[model samples]
Target: MKIRISKATIVDERHPDNGKKRDILIENGKITKIAASIKTEVDKVIESEGLCVSIGWMDMRANFRDPGDEQKEDLESGLKAAANGGFTAVALMPSTNPPIDNKGAVEYLLNRAKSGKVQVVPIGTISKKRAGESLAEMYDMYRAGAKAFSDDKESISESGLLHRALLYTKNFDATVIHFPYDATLIPNGQINEGVQSTLLGLKGIPAIAEEMMVARDLTLLEYTNGRLHLGPVSSAMSIKRIASAKKDGLRITCETTAAHIAYSENELENFDTNFKVLPPLRSEQNRKELIKLLKSGKIDVISSDHSPEDEEHKKLEFDYANFGMASIESFFPVLYTAVGSSMDLAKLVATFSINPRRILDLEIPEIKEGVRANLTLFSISEKTVFEKMNLKTKGYNVAEIGKELNGKVLAIFS
Candidate 1:
């Protein structure tokens, strides 16, 4: 029997189903029927009140600690969490234990993440072992199925090394990602450098650290004429910088996380480590500006930056705690609630769906008959509270623990 979904509103602007409510019958993982009514018995039925469906969503930045650090998350559990969060595809970060650097590592990840309802795209390291030294075999990893390359959480400090990586990857049209962090400037930085850090008496990472690195990369992109994606940016100034760079005709793109868009430095007043992320959360003004920037399309995609840190690293004292938030499971609801009214619902949803795949140069799903059953059943008006029972990630970040969310993801069919 086929899976039948009746009266589910379609929201993908790319297809004829953009604003239609129809009965969709899926058989053998393909949509066989789409009409106002269908008289057919099916093995599975997904017809709920006010439900909406769109192309399967994607998260371009997420980590599944396989090959090592499985305690944080393995491939299967990570996919379960992603499916629960409405993502049908995710780009796995190369920051794992052995690290995804060479062609072998990329093959291993692709094999390990073979199935389970989500496509796992690996991001190869810019340097071998992510040591910021000699460049890794970019062409080899690309041949092994890496869509992009990055050093993840560590910026390439040496201009010569970064310059070489950018100039080299341009040969095959591969995109290079950079995390903007100046190690010397913010040596002991713990949180965003502002009134909150001063009042809390904790170390701070100034916005300039992020801006400076972003500026450097933009300059290099102008020089090398390379394709670059600056990610997890959290400052207002950096957004403006990238927008200006884009206007200047440099091949550049950027992304910001849902956590940075939802929470500001105020959340760190309690010294909660879950709020501690690299390119640390900034002031309220920056948060508001981030939403506005996202609405204006300055930020190309909204990623979960779904970094998962285990209890041993997260449950430590404020100063001793590791930096991260296990956030893929909370990306949709948390993001919808924070900017549901501010940003266009269709555009915001696209940020998590088509935009990510487009940036990675992958095929985007369309919600029409005769297509594969790649979709996320969701609702924007539904209210949700993420409690212990609902938190699917191995690590829980406090920002979304008790927050009231404005969206609900029913299921994903692929």
Candidate 2:
């Protein structure tokens, strides 16, 4: 398979051709040559104005709902959505019906995703069956190819359990990913706690719910000297805490979602179920703070948090609806539309391509000759519409439909 990418500006900072427009040639899945111009015959040629190339993007957190709730999203559909979203790899959350807490489950996901262009890295459960009562087989699952350990969207309320898990994973140099929220504080809450919830007569989830857990986790990480990744964080205070922890030299990393940075609680004014998400969209002030911190590199990665729910679970009253959005296909477009003008292209590429892989201890691909062609091609000037037809996931819960976004993913090579 031969392909030529003409007049594309390289966005990888590690490459000498960074920010320079050049022709790239790939033969048999490896980069063969790069020059100012190449007049060569190939199986396909890709050329476009404002075309940009980077190391393949990776999503650190996402829910595919495979092996149990395939009706919502299967491995094939999820990988297709990831490829369309400019991600060559995604970390699957262990939140399925039969949770991925064992060696067999981790092996199953790896085997199923082996033939796909988009890689699937399974995240094993932190607790047995995601029950939060006992620790899962961390070492065994890690040996079976699980990249990290997490109980997705399920907060660990017991301090002793989290402490034990952190200490246990340290022996193998594994990272423990935790969603920062205290469920007990907002068991019935529907949206961010503020004027919107008051005006709509719905229960509200206060920012303290997230901040308190983040503080607890940071303390645990500091005491145990273990690597910890916290994310899909929404509160401004939580970000301040994580930033301070980093200054104190704790082994901590965090992430925020595209939806969190792009939309606020204002989207819930109309009772749209698609706008309902966990760590619900915060106030406009918090959204701006998130963007500022992300630009300053306080945040390490940006994930889609692509949770897919079937219509039966989504098309209900706001109070009863599920908390998620099928957002993988719209990930890069939403971020590009919301923050492209104010962000540096190289820094944005690092968040998606370099930082996430480093956090997970995975191999980071380079955009140089003699390397395998794991890359994403995109155009910042191209405009795309987010509509139902563009979605590849089985769930149709995206809230950005009908809006025009600034970027388009041209193709993926893996």
Candidate 3:
């Protein structure tokens, strides 16, 4: 899909080499030339207005229930949701019914995702069956195109087992995406452990559960010297520990979800299960610190963490409900609300697009001349009311369900 983007602000977050605001000519999927008003023959020309064009966005964590759990979400529908959410690449987590523990399942999902327009990289399970007992077939799964290893929604605790998995993934020179939570402390917890939980009479997931586990993982990472991506670090204490680890020169990076930045556990006061999530939301101070880390480059990436659950799972009582949210549709909009007004566009693009692609060691083409038009076009000022009609995921659970937000994903080019 060759096209000439005229009068477009080329925001290649990866390449500070290419100065911003230039007309680009994309020919045969490679950036051909980047210049001011290039006179080139092309099939089509795009008149971009009020648009920030950048290299494709990448979501480091997203759960698309394909293969055995298609009733919740299939590969095709998940890819559509991703595309509409302005993502060109998504890392699929291994939390399916059968779990992506073996090479065959890894191959199946890799092939299935390749059939879609977006690049869907499946993450292999860190533990066999995600039971936290034994390690999965990491070598075979890596051979089958699994980019990283994780247990999806939770940490593979059992210290001995996680230590072995980390060392094994180190053998493949692949990063481990640890979910950073101690399941023992969070048994039956419905929301963040705080005053709100006491008022609502709901079980609480203590923030220390996340911080303690993260602290342990960082120590192991220091000893192992392997790439580690601490995914969805939800607490301020965890953030401080990770920041300190990075300063001490650990080969580690971390990310937080879009919802983590926009909302806190206070939303759970109404006993709304939709606001419930694993490693549940913390205090406003925690949210502010997360934003600070993202802006300061301490936190490496931002993802949708788009875990989807059906109506049967979400509409139940808070304790009976599942821990997940459908953020594939709300990711970009929620981000705009967090820092769009204060931070510059380049930093935002770096968090959403450049950092994640770099973390996966994927090839990132600059938004320059003669490149294939793999890009995301969005307006940070466009406002839209989020509802069922606006959501593409089968799951409608979100903290900002009816809240007004200031951004919209116009299109995704792959």
Best of the candidates, TM-score:
2
Q: Which ten residues in a row have the lowest lDDT in candidate 1?
A: 390-399
Better of 1 and 2 by TM-score: 2
**Using Cα atoms with residue i matched to residue i, what is each candidate's TM-score against the true structure?**
0.97, 0.98, 0.94
- Give lDDT per model, in order: 0.88, 0.91, 0.80
Using TM-score as the measure, what is the rank order of every candidate, best first?
2, 1, 3
State the lDDT of candidate 1 residue by residue for 272-387, as single tens digits.
88898887999999999999999998988889988888878888889888888899988888788789866666778888899889888899888777888899998876877888
- Per residue, candidate 3 scores C-alpha lDDT tens digits across 1-414 of 557777666666456543355667776667777776778788988764555677888988998888676777878878888998899999899998899999999888877677677898888998889998988898999988888889977677777877887788877788788888887886777778888888988878888888889988988888888788997888867877888888889888888888898888877778888788877888888888888877777777888998888888889977888888888888888888877767667777787788887777778756654456688877655775787776667765765677888877777777
- Model 2 segments more than 4 A misplaced: none
In terms of lDDT, the best-performing candidate is: 2
Q: How many backbone clashes does candidate 1 have?
A: 0
Model 2, 14-129: lDDT tens per residue?
88889999999999999999999988899989998789999999999999998899999999999999998999999999999799999999999999999999999999999998
Clashes of each: 0, 0, 14
TM-score between model 3 and native: 0.94
User: Sorted by lDDT, highest first, which candidate order results?
Assistant: 2, 1, 3
